[model samples]
Target: MGRQVLTWIGAQAAASGRRYVRLATARDDRPLRAYYERAGYRHVGDPPHAKWPTSLYERAIESG
Candidate 1:
């Protein structure tokens, strides 16, 4: 299931000019971080957004 989703995302990113994809989860989503990391997302940093902390990660698609 994860592989299928990743493949779909890759295809979507290729078709669309998506520079990066992000998911903002609650603090209690600590367990889910491991799953995302294994999918090539790195923990870039955490920045406070709105009233919650946002975990930022990115994948490069093209040169800036």
Candidate 2:
């Protein structure tokens, strides 16, 4: 189900001429972080924010 949702999102983003699919996750969630890493998203950076700690990730959209 997660992969399906990612596929759908990639499709939509590609249709709109986007270059990448970016997301943020809680920095301390190791399991969730691993899941995204296994899904091919690379750890980009953690930008400063006033709210909860976040880790950014991005996956390039494959040209069709």
Candidate 3:
């Protein structure tokens, strides 16, 4: 189901002329991080705000 959602999202982004998809998840959630990584998202970096710790990830949207 996750993969399906990602596929849909990628399609929508491509239709909108976007090149990448970006998301943020809790920094300490190892399992969730691994899941995103397995989905082809690469860890970009953390946001500069100190109020909350989050890990940023980005995946390139392939052109069809």
Identify the leading candidate in terms of lDDT.
Answer: 2
For each candidate, the alpha-carbon lDDT, in order, equals: 0.67, 0.94, 0.93
Candidate 1 residues 1-64, lDDT tens each? 9868866776678679787766555545786777778777777777765477566665554433
Steric clashes per prediction: 0, 0, 0
* Candidate 2 structure quality by residue, lDDT tens digits, 1-64: 9989988999999999999999999998999999999999999988787289999999999997
Q: Report lDDT (Cα) of residue 48, candidate 1.
A: 61
Q: What is the lDDT of residue 49 in candidate 3?
A: 87
Q: Per-residue lDDT for 1-64 in model 3, tens only?
A: 9989988998999999999999899998999999999999999998888478899999999987
- Misplaced by over 4 Å in model 2 are none
**Ranking, lDDT, top scorer first:** 2, 3, 1
- Which candidate model has the greater TM-score, 2 or 3? 2
Candidate 1 lands at a TM-score of 0.63
Candidate 1 clash total? 0
Clashing pairs in 2: none
Worst 10 residues of 2 by lDDT: 45-54
Off by more than 4 A, model 3:
none
In model 1, state the lDDT of residue 55: 69
TM-score of each: 0.63, 0.93, 0.91
- Candidate 3: Cα lDDT at 3: 88
